[model samples]
Target: MIQRIQTIFLFLVVVCMGITIGTELWEQAVNGQSWKLSAFAVENLSADGEVVSSSSKWYIGALAAFVGLLALISIFQYKSRGRQMMLNMINSLLMVGLVASVFLTTNGLNSELGMEVAGSYKVGFWVILAAMVCNMLANRFIRKDEALVRSVDRIR
Candidate 1:
């Protein structure tokens, strides 16, 4: 029952991340605008001062990949308990990566452009943080269950 709930929650988190990334991409392609103000300048940077490559698409792709990976893990978790624990650990790490990316990207944008792009990034940051917390809670519950089973076996 608990595992089912955790799977549902993780699915929701993956969907939310996908939506957020999709929104950012739409903003970039349709509006010709940076998804977040901080992304604007970074997207414009040229490694050699002659070839400008935007990081926006790469970042969005990364998010999409992470979401896809999480969805796959969630689906497979039911088949193997060990895989479930591994997936939980991997998801937690992905959440950490998401948080770090949000902070660094936001800070990079803010320091270079002065808070103009903070709102979008802030929203993404908070959403990812909430997802991270949920993942952590789910992992703890699974660990507790494992411990309980071990204790019961020892008692017998």
Candidate 2:
């Protein structure tokens, strides 16, 4: 079951979510000010590039961890594709919230620093989006597998 294509996809979903914790989600810089947001922390810098402040944003990290845990759990539910599919859907919704929260928090922080929302999404954003895509792919394959099993049963 672990060798299945959907299993691989599901595993990648977990890996991507886990990686988000260590990566920057968004950033901005203008006129000697810069702000960077990661999963668990946000950094602010003055014009001199000195570390002005850093604050813990634990909720982002916690949500990301929950998403990863769900994907990992889904990978092991190979015997029940229905349950796996449900979990995948839930994971997808969670991922959407995760992305929105990251951007919202970053924008809030950027505004506080008097910088326009000029920065694009960083590597972490892409990774979470990748996980969402993987979850969708895995769900599709799971449905295919269920249909195959039902066809074989009906033939018997």
- On lDDT, the leading prediction is 2
* Candidate 1 lDDT over residue span 1-156, tens digit each: 434666666666676565545443111211233433221223543333342445543664475467547755665566565577788788778767755665666566556545443434444445566677666666666677677778999999
**TM-score of every model versus the real structure:** 0.64, 0.93
Q: Taking the tens digit of each residue's C-alpha lDDT, what string does model 2 give over 1-156?
A: 677899999999889987898888887877677777889888888988788999998999999999999999999999888999999999999999998898788778767666655587899889998998999999999999999999999999
Error of 1 at 62 (Å): 1.4
Model 2 clash tally?
Answer: 0
lDDT of 2: 0.88
Q: What's model 2's TM-score? A: 0.93
